[model samples]
Target: MDKLLSNIKIEVPPGIYLKDPESSSLGKKIVENSIILLENIGFEDFNFKKLGQLIGSNESSIYRYFESKHKLLIYLTSWYWSWIEYQLVLETYSINDTKDKLIKAIEIVSRTTKQDSKYSHINEVLLNQIVINENSKSYLTKDVDIENKDGSFMPYKRVVQRISEIISAYNTSYKYPLTLASSVIESALHQQFVKIHFKSITNCNDEITPTEFFIDLTLKTLTDGK
Candidate 1:
């Protein structure tokens, strides 16, 4: 899988950036340090100037890649989902049974992220943390409608659609596959957030994981009427 992924490029919408960050060393440095800095300071406190200082580049150089911090966040989130989508496809493609495929897909998306050595510059674990803690800010904007039209969120939507198709295949009679698919993905992130900050409100803890919860819920919901 690592070998195959080494040859693959995680595509983010070109519209989100003024330049491709993966094309050059400085660009990669910008992305690499931006992730570390964003995880350290968060989006609200994160800015191009701070990232410039961390990367030893001018603030204008950062803008040469991303137009704004919001766009950078979108780029990071998009890359994260694209990475997950690749794993979802590669891991679940060989399963013959529909239910088994759906379950595997759920696990791939809902499971906690670990670092992948393939992309040495970008840290998948920190990127996952950003996705869990700061993902909504990427699209929850007045410009979201315009951005959606521009395909800025395509990677995320593709993951949901892929899982939704598997759900429909597992249970043809299921009336809300899309809703359920999106819920599973979104709820997994939310559950992780609550587990860390509001433990009293969530069932997920050391003993139980969000992956286990979603898989159980999905199987029950899809099988209940059948």
Candidate 2:
């Protein structure tokens, strides 16, 4: 699986960046350091100048890749989702049982992320943190409709659609597979956020995980507690 993944390139929408960050060493450095800096200083305080200082490059050089921090966030989130979609397809594609495939798919999207050696330039763990905390900012904008039309959110939508197909295969009569699939993905992020920031409000912790909760929720909802 690692060998197969190493050969895969996670592509984001070309419209999101002024230049493709995966095309050059300097571009890759911009992406690698930007993840670390964004997680450290957060989206609100993160700027190209700070990233430039961290990478020992000029601010204008950073701008050559991303036009603005908002677009950069979209790129990061898009890349992360594309990576997750790859994991989903690779891990679940061979499972012959419909229910088993759905369970595996849920676990892949809901489980806490760990760094994969295939993409050393990306820290999946930190990228997961940014997704959990700042994912909404990428789309909750007046321009989201415009961006969606331009395929800015295709990676994320594709993930939901894949899982939704699994749900339908598991239960042909299920009327809201897409809704359930999207809810599980979005809620997984929210559950992780509350688990870390508002622990008193969520049951997920060291013993119980968001993965377990979503697995239970999805199965029960689909099967009506069968």
Candidate 3:
């Protein structure tokens, strides 16, 4: 179990980068600054030359780590999901109650992540902002099919699968465990996106995060027929 493992390593698909960003100090710096820049200017306005200036590295150096801006975005978002997966396990590991596990899973996925101080190399908090605002851009492209086949989305799918298993513990016969899991995860993102950008339409209370609402709705769907 990932929860029980120590010093866990997350694998970004080999296709996502020309070189592993964690391997060298410079490569790691590129990743650390990439998050800050992507969250600051947004991906549409982000480029290697700009990143090169930010990190005092040449554009060619950035290219050596990532083939294109698109791949970099994918790498960042994939890393975000992997981080989320770890948190999900850490948060829910002690809960034996199925409903409690389900609720915690939803919150961990939906709520903004706190920056993990031990991981100074990556800013979990800022990365969550990028995931909220720009994650779709990583996959909504012409190469999505190619990337998808190459396991670009496996980290994300693994997260969803973990939560889906928690749901199954409550209702093993539930035909739509994965479906329900995917819906809950996406709903968290969309609700927060809408609440932030188009608040007039969302009636959510400011005191309560979307995670609470999602958990209530998910519980209704899972327990309504019982």
TM-score of 2: 0.98
Clashing residue pairs, backbone N/CA/C < 3 A, model 1: none
Which regions of candidate 3 fall more than 4 Å away from where they truly are? 1-6
Task: Please list all clashing residue pairs in model 3, or write none if there are none.
Answer: none
- lDDT (tens digit, per residue) of candidate 2 on 1-226: 5676689899898999999999999999999998999999899999998899999999999889899999999999999999999899899979999999999999999998988988889999999999999999999999999999999999999999999999999999999999999999999999999999999999999999999999999999999823
Cα-based TM-score, every candidate: 0.98, 0.98, 0.94
Stretches of candidate 2 off by over 4 Å are none
The backbone clash count of each candidate, in order, is 0, 0, 0
Candidate 1, 82-170: lDDT as tens digits: 99999998899899999889889999988889999889999999999999999999989999999999999999999999999999999
Consecutive 10-residue window with the lowest summed lDDT within model 1: 1-10
Which candidate has the top score in lDDT?
A: 2
RMSD list, candidates in order? 0.9, 1.1, 2.3
What would you estimate as the lDDT of candidate 2? 0.94
1 against 2, candidate with superior lDDT: 2
TM-score of 1: 0.98
